[model samples]
Target chain A: MLAGSQNRVQCTEIVLFGVNVAMSWAAVQGWFHKLASPPHFYVTAGRWVPWLGASTVVLLAVGLGWSLFIAPLDQYQGASTRIMYLHVPAAWMSIFVYLVMAGSAAVGLVWRMRLAEVIAASSAPLGAWFTFLALATGSLWGKPMWGTWWVWDARLTSELLLLFLYLGFMALQAAIPDRRAGARASALLALVGVVNIPIIHFSVVWWNTLHQPSSILRLGKPTIHPSILWPLLVMAIAFKLYYMTVVLLRARCALLERERSSAWVQQIVTEQIALCHPLR
Target chain B: MIVDPQTSPRLGRALRTVLVRDLTLALRRRGELANPLVFFVVVVTMFPLGLGPEVDLLARIAPGILWVAALLAALLSLEAMFHPDYQDGSLEQLLLTPHPLAVLVIAKVFAHWLTTGLPLLVLAPLLGVLLQLPESATGVLVISLALGTPTLSFIGAIAVALTVGLRRGGVLLSLLTLPLYVPVLIFGAGAVDSAAGGLSVVAHLSFLATLLILAISLAPWAIAAALRISLE
Candidate 1:
């Protein structure tokens, strides 16, 4: 009888495990479907925007302060090295945002998801801004150290090309009158342009070696001191948060514009009107 | 849904029809076909005049100038790739055909290369002489243009397909394509530079060939996808 009970218990345990796996899978699917729905996404993003914005502001302030003041000076670059706190994070985010845009674009194209398109359109300008910041700051840093306003370095040139790509994406999106078509068209351009980033980097590196030989060596290549590295990491996270905040804001605006005729948008507008008039 | 096999052509026949039709249209519009070639010569000519007639200086910069001009000229012709078809509703008809759209796009791009890129390849050596590019490098210059220009047409076709439905797409098309053109420009010009320096041109030529292979294989599907998006 005890042996029989043990076998029954083992069977029940296996059954429970299978049921748990199936339950979690359904839950994940349910969550994905809810997020894909525009109204659900709008609500979820609206709720998170304030927290993301707050964290971005707080983290950026702390990171910048620490980087500029508290971080140890570079043995070679000295105070000029502080520019890296801004440049590196901005550069990282610029590339990261493009990948995100491209990923979202691919998702939108494959699944025909409306929210994915909104995310892509919203991310382009922010990506452009970060890329511009990277170039401008890199130029500023170069002038003092390299003794020139610019050098045709691989990273710098690729960053410049990235800026042009962003402009092209925006131009393509704006030129197409239909919103959905424009989204898909720009998405295709974004995907195609992603291939150039690596080529630009490598070609510029090859060109630099061919032309300049050893004039400009890579700066800050040795292991970074923790004092400096920590703030840089903080700044990178802050920039990511900043991107999230701005993308959410822009996407919310885009969602409203695209879905103005939808029932949920109408309800939101009516609620806003009622809140403002109160007595009417 | 039952139908006679006689009415509909097979995939190969459909692809051939697209190629033949595009070639015939291009031939009929002789002026349009000549525009890019003319633009190439004019642009290449501007550099020597602008920088003064220093033979060595011109020769030093000739490969770059010629390649850049050819790239821009190719771009100028790209707007016409799908604009006429898109306007007259044949692009839609082409999409509706049973043959896959990518095959049709490949045929169209191939015809574009033959019309725009082939002429540029033939005319490059003349520009080489005008720029005083080194005699040894002239062969590599033509070779590079021959290999690289088709890739440009293929890459440029994606941009043109995306913008074909828009009214003011010409300027936007250039903006969209020029960044993507950088690699081809780098490698093509590098091949000539290598040859001029008495180095083996194998590496640069191989790079260009790789780009051509990649562009040919991947760009048609992108162009077809973009065309459908634009049409929708």
Candidate 2:
């Protein structure tokens, strides 16, 4: 009788554990749907904006301060080498944000998720800006280091091509009048870009690239001094935070645009007007 | 879909029907057929004039010039690949059909290559002589172009499909496609450049063939998706 009761207890425990697993799985799915929905995501993202913005600003200030004032000068390249802080981080963000944009694009395409579409669309201009920043800053540094302005190096060419890809995406989106169709169409292009980007990166290696090899992303220990590497890494983090803050803000704007006729947007607009004009 | 596109007899019949229909349509407008080929010739000629009739310089640059002109010619014809079908309501009919849209897209792209890319391939040797391209290198140039232009047609069709719904998609189509064309240009011209310089052309040709196979296998689905989006 005691043994029977113990078996019963064990079976009850097993059933309860299975029940708990099922419930949590359902809850996670529910949370995902809630987050993916536009109005829900809008409210949630708006709440995140100030925090993201504050963190970004704080980190950026510190990163810049450390990068310019605190970091020691390289004995060989001297002051021009300091451009590494801006150039490397921007370059990293250019590729990092492209992956984000393309990944969101794929999600938006496959699931037809509205917030994913907004995130994908919002990320394009930021990626382009960082790419152009990287290119421009790298060129400025190159003129002094390499004795010329451009060499059509592998990374340089691929990055320039990446900028053009971003432009093409934006242009395609602008040309399409139907919002959903436009988003999905550009999403398709981004998927294709993801496939081709690696080819672009490697194809130009056949050319005798004069650009310096990567220092941080390679295998084994990074070749740079710890002090310089830290500031650069800190700057990378700050740029990433900046991207997150702006993208969330942009996603909110895009969501508003996408859902302009919805009731929630209408209520938010009216509330904003009332807040702006208290007398009214 | 039920019978499987590969084993079923319908796939072959469908491919032939589209190919014949496109070729017949292209033949009906014989003057338009010559436009890209003639454009290819004129563009090649302009290079000699712009750079002067310097044989050595022309020979040095012929591979790049011919490859680029061929690419542009292929691009010029690409806008028509689906625009006409889309306008005539056949594109909608195509989507509604039970057959896979990818098969139809590839058929149309193949017909487009036959009309545009083949002519450029045939004319490449003549232009090679005009550019004073090395006699030995001429073989490599023709072969590489023959291998490469079909890939361009296939890839360019995706852009055309995406742009077919827009009124002014001409410039937009080029902007979308030119970056994608870089790999083909590199390999096609690289093959000839290497051949002219007495370097082995094996690597470049293999790359071109690999790209062609990739385009053949993958481009149709992308074109079909783009066409669907445009229609939507």
Runs in model 2 lying further than 4 Å from the true structure: A1-20, A209-222, B1-9
Model 2 Cα lDDT, one tens digit per residue, A37-127? 8888889998998998999899889889999999988766778878889999999999999999999999998999988989999999999
Model 1 lDDT, full chain set: 0.91
Query: Which digits, one per residue and each the tens of the lDDT, describe model 1 over residues B1-232?
Result: 4435889888888888999999999999999999999999999989988999999999889989999999999999998899999889999999988778998899999998999999887899988999888899989999999999999999999999998888888999899999999989999999998888899999889989998999988998999999999888
TM-score of each: 0.96, 0.93
CA shift at B147, candidate 2, in angstroms?
1.5
C-alpha DockQ of every model: 0.82, 0.70
Each candidate: what lDDT? 0.91, 0.88
lDDT of 2 at A197: 84
Best by DockQ: 1
lDDT score at residue B71, model 1, on the 0-100 scale: 92
* CAPRI category for model 1: high
Runs in model 1 deviating more than 4 A are A1-16, B1-4
